[model samples]
Target: MDDSRAKGPPADADINLTEPAPVEASLTDNPQKLKIAYEQTILYARDLNLKIGELKQAEKALRQNAADLAVLFEASQVFLSQNNIETTLQTACQLIVSRFDLQLSWVGVLTNDENEIHPAAVYPPHDHSDSHPLNQVGASSAAGQELIRQAIHTTQAVASRYSEPEARQAQPAALTDDAYSLAALPLLHNGEVLGVMSVYSRQPDYFTPDRLQILQSFANLTAVALVKARLFERLQLLSQQLVDAQEAERRHIARELHDEIGQTLTAVKINLQAMQRRSGVSDLTASLQESMDIVEQAIQQVRNLSLDLRPSLLDDLGLVATLRWYLDRQARWAGLSTQLTVTPSNLQLPANLETVCFRLVQEALTNALRHAQAQTIQVDLQQHDKELQLVIGDDGLGFEVEPTLKRVAYGKGLGLVGMQERVSLLGGRFELESAPGQGTQIRVFLPVPPALAEDRSA
Candidate 1:
């Protein structure tokens, strides 16, 4: 009933209705207080600016760390993916040159003499002309110029600014600009310097401590890979030597048995035959004939054993005749049809080549007989101007090729590995093709001089 009066009446007794109340004391009005307020505002603004700057710095650091991790990841992938030293260095250098702010990258292996760092792989920069070139600098020099040499000698990472005279002298040429730095890390494994990895960048002081640590890790991984490759190569060499020694021993034994036992048997048979012809008593003649027959059989057995050890035909008649003889024998024994085609019919190969070809064919045939359950096989051999090629094929149930490779790598398929090593030792190529149900084929190419065939034929 009186809502307006009730809302207005209780507050009216001693109050001014219209005039604004006296302004309260505040920093907004007083000079000093206002100045203080302005100063505080400025201080807060400055603090905000500083905080933003710090946040930006943190963001940049995070980005840099991410890039470093990515680079390390790629280096690790390189170590995992590549088994060859040349390919590994090439790929790893390329990755670094592409991903990082780098001008050039190179990898050099320490020679056994420890005198030189031979450049194994190099990744040139965007402007190839301005790129820092790799120099084969001596490790022990008075100049102290070679970062790579220093790193290797100390088995540590070394860094230098491109502007330094000694560092500049160590580089291939003057940089297009002075804004560059260099770092060299020793590739060390088990306390030995395997090689050196050098990187060039377009920023001064590019090799920070954090980056140096990552690079050192990369170098270590590279060294481990190099060691593994070296061990494999050494193992292959030892295997080849063992195979050679075995062959030599076989040849020696075969020669001794043929020369000593074969001749004696032949002489004994001739004497017995003469005795049989001259004997007066029937019983004595019969006994002499029987002895002659026994000696002849023994001689035949000795000849067979000698041939098996190392065929005289392989030495005398050469690979062609021996292969023909062997193929004929295999056809009879294994009951498999074989077709062999050797171009020019009068090809003569080096002893190693002949032995490798013969062994390859022999092993192929043996595998077919023992495992393939195949009926027919084909072999093609050709001599080219710069290479010799061999192709062998079979019509049998095939198998997965990858698992076989893994097995060979782990030393299980020695026959296959032996064949491969023989070809590789001669700088040849060997390849196999197969599948679950189709068939199997082997192809080989051996780099050879054209004159090799002609010289042997002559």
Candidate 2:
């Protein structure tokens, strides 16, 4: 009997016995099935584990990207806000130190000679010993110098795991014994290299290609910032130079008028007096008197011209006395009612500050006399803390303060421009307020020098 028939299934009668029995296989005959199942299970588990690892890696990359983006955004904002090289570099250094886990980072700006680079920013790693020779890299080292030069010339990023021969020769003790990696990136703007950014690591292969690329991008951004800061500095220098030249010219003109025209007027007055003394006849008396009157008028004109060029009172006396003299003259000439108020009567200011204040007052009075058709003017000077303030107001039929009015009215009026320039040169604040049917008010605020303030107090 067949072994299957011998073991007949009679316990479960519901099952048909003679159904040509489905193809049957024993565990012993196909023992490889167990091994195959085990292999498939291992592969499936491995694939799942790999997928999980990939997801984690992707998440980590995403977070890093976000962090980098945030840093770039902050850097951009800071770059735009600052207007000078020192502040910009300081901000950049702080940001990099705060954001990156860097061993060493620094910015090297090309010097005027273009052969040397100056350290603008430097961040030393925590583990770096203060006595290490690398500490002097920024000051004097072939490696640092060559890195800067290469970055500037190539306008591209460079990295080196091994110390260059020249650098080792220049600072053998520093590089020969130390195994530090370096990266140098060109800071470029508008296809021009402005500077170099360098980073150092005590460990070999500390930076990857991707990290170098990121640094290069940061360098590009920094380049724009540096360019903007440099441009701003240049503009400021040019403006200051122009102001200095203009002031020098004005002083020269003022001196010329006082020495030349003033002396001639004095001589004319002397001659007229002599002629009047010699002529005693009544017929000639009238002519001589007329001549005397003309000479007196000429003398007055000459004095006025001299005063306009540079007030003698300003140089001889202080701002308050000079302003008093100016107001008296203006009141007499314009025939306008004038009021003067001065607080802290013993107020004295720096020479430059005094000059600015006097000029502002003079310009305001001139504007009122020439254009303001006002009958009454008030001039006030006050001191508070470290500040000196001057306010000149007039009860004039004021014009609109709109741009159109400013362009038309102030175009012909150099008084406003002159006053503004004086105040600006003194590092003061100036404001003009006026509207149609409203009176004009000119206010100036100047910071008093400590020495002058002490002198006034004394």
For TM-score, the strongest prediction is 1
Candidate 1's displacement at residue 310, Å, is: 2.7
After superposing candidate 2 on the true structure, give the runs of residues whose Cα lies further than 4 Å from its correct spot: 1-83, 91-106, 121-150, 158-185, 189-192, 197-256, 280-283, 335-345, 373-415, 421-434, 437-458
Deviation in Å, model 2, residue 366 alpha carbon: 2.7
lDDT of 1 by residue, 1-458 (tens): 33453233232243223332333477456887565455545544555555677679899989988887888787776677565667777877787777776767778887889888787887762233432354322222222247876897799998866565555555445554544677888888899898888887767788898888877877787788777767766776887788789879878888877999999999998888888788899999988888888888998888877877788788898888898898888788778788889986888787878888888988887777777887888989888766889998998888899999999999998889888988887768899999977778999999776678556445
Model 2, residue pairs in steric clash: none
TM value for model 2 = 0.60
Predicted candidate 2 versus true structure: per-residue lDDT over 1-458, tens digit per residue: 23544343444243332222222355336767655444445544555555677679899989988888888888898899887787787676566656766555778788888776777876653235544444545324566667767767777787766545534543335445445566788888788777787776655576688777777877888888888988877876777678667656766777777788767867887886787788888778788778768877876776667678777677788888888888887889879888889888877676667767776777777777777788899989998777888999998888777662467455645667667766765657888899877989988888888876666666
In order, candidate lDDTs are 0.76, 0.72
